[model samples]
Target: MNTETNILNILGEQIKLGERKEVNFDVANLHTASAINVPIIIERSKKPGPTVLFTAGIHGDEVNGVEIVRQLIAKGINKPKSGTVICMPIINIFGFINLKREFPDGRDLNRVFPGSKNGSLASRVAHKLITEIVPHADYIIDFHTGSSGRFNAPQLRIVKHNQQLRGLAKVFGAPFVLYSKNLNKSFRTVCNKLGKPLLLFEGGKSFHIDNIVTNTGVNGAKRILFYLGMLSSKFKVSTPKKDCVFIEESKWIRAKLSGMFKASVKINAKVEKGDLLGNITDPYGKMNYFVKADYSGYIINVNESPVVYQGDALFHITKKLIR
Candidate 1:
């Protein structure tokens, strides 16, 4: 991730210190040969510091993440006091354009990392990202949202026992820090392999934007920048309203019967065993089944969809906490 004191080369462009550049990360053209532009916004200070990269919209439907990164640029937060701040607000331009989560071919861009140049369209983009962009990043913060109709409390996800990540997660100061393993072939895994520190933020749900979630994400980014001495002088970092809850383990509560669903509780709600979390009912009103927490814990995720099928995850509850 090292770069020269005077020059930073990204996507075949040489950006000097104190220079600003908006480079397009173009991969392909549309069927009509219309070129798609994936803009990479870069800001560099004359003084030397760490290069932090902010990214979002790997999944097209995850608009909340996109909004957070957009706020950073629009607010001039990406202009660091020292070093460089890179923003690629939308990576999967195909999905972002089509309003789908995956590539036009239905492949998850995240699942194909360190991609091949000669591979599928998604793979080529991955390859370009890993090869062309990621090498310049000393730190990376990737934003994401819950899939389908699941609403997630603002949180950071990192594997357990990595002290570097553990400290950075605390610095980011999201509401919750969940210890999860890096999935193989994922963006996190690839970045980890390349020795780039990454903080993965998950909030809200797909195809939706929440103001609170957006603020949490934006504030967390500012905190990290402040910690790194990269935040501009004009921006003020806010103290987290509460201490981060470190979840050591968690489990998903699944639906026992398929039916109309309604959650009685909200995300981040702490519940006791047997507490009524929600209920399911037949459309005809002939049957109603109360959903209760099987064990005492905090709810990190709640399925917000009105209708669900049997065995669908209803809630994600914490099983253990890091004291």
Candidate 2:
């Protein structure tokens, strides 16, 4: 489908482009059952500007944002003198070849949103990837980490009322910046109901690779492509605080009485309103069960699978929620 109009979001939905490198390279239901093809890539830049998309492993064990988009595609993009840069490293190849993190139909591709095209098959592949790659993107960044057993650090989670998307999440520095404030149903609420502007790089976990959340998400996506001029020089990015201590509200503290667990607070600690965040021993510790912190923010995430079950999930509190 190269109608002489540049080639980047390069997907052939109705089917066309051949020498494929995989981007919307269909296969949803063409004969059998073992299928998975959702790829996209673009790099345009003969001037023009603004169009920076960069997603990754939509929860297929959050592969460090597919290594932070191949470290910004090896820092090239050939001609971005002004704009354009799209990528989708790995949307979920059967939950990344059974590495497992949801999406082999167990569903959870970012809670399957903005989808439909006759739904189901992960809602028609998340509605043909939000109608063929995020409405032509002009700012979307979804790369995560912190799932498998659980671990996060290089932060930068926006949705806290999008103050310029939390000033592009502190120029992607990553030392802890988790504002977050979406009422669930994500993909950052389907790119905030179409206005686009999105960002959610939680940082390192699941199968591991935490070079400070991949160097603060590859230099915060090239300091947001040089703060959106597409690049003509721009690289300081990292003041990291737009008052970002919101956490308007949050919840999830399971394992009410299981077996192992120890946590005495670590992953970004800062508790108080009850503080104790650790306990649930048995196998030989002769029974214990502390784990308290009913209120007072900043534990961001917990649970490293030291074996537990009475309810599973251990900590995810954010209090004062943000948004």
Cα lDDT computed for each candidate against the true fold: 0.94, 0.69
Clashes of each: 0, 11
- In terms of lDDT, model 2 sits at 0.69
Residue-wise C-alpha lDDT for candidate 2, range 218-277, written one tens digit per residue = 777776777666654534445544344545466777887879888889876778778788
Instruction: Give the TM-score (vs. native) of candidate 2.
Output: 0.38
Best candidate, TM-score-wise? 1
Model 1: pairs clashing at backbone N, Cα or C within 3 Å? none
Report the number of backbone clashes for model 2.
Answer: 11
Give TM per candidate: 0.99, 0.38
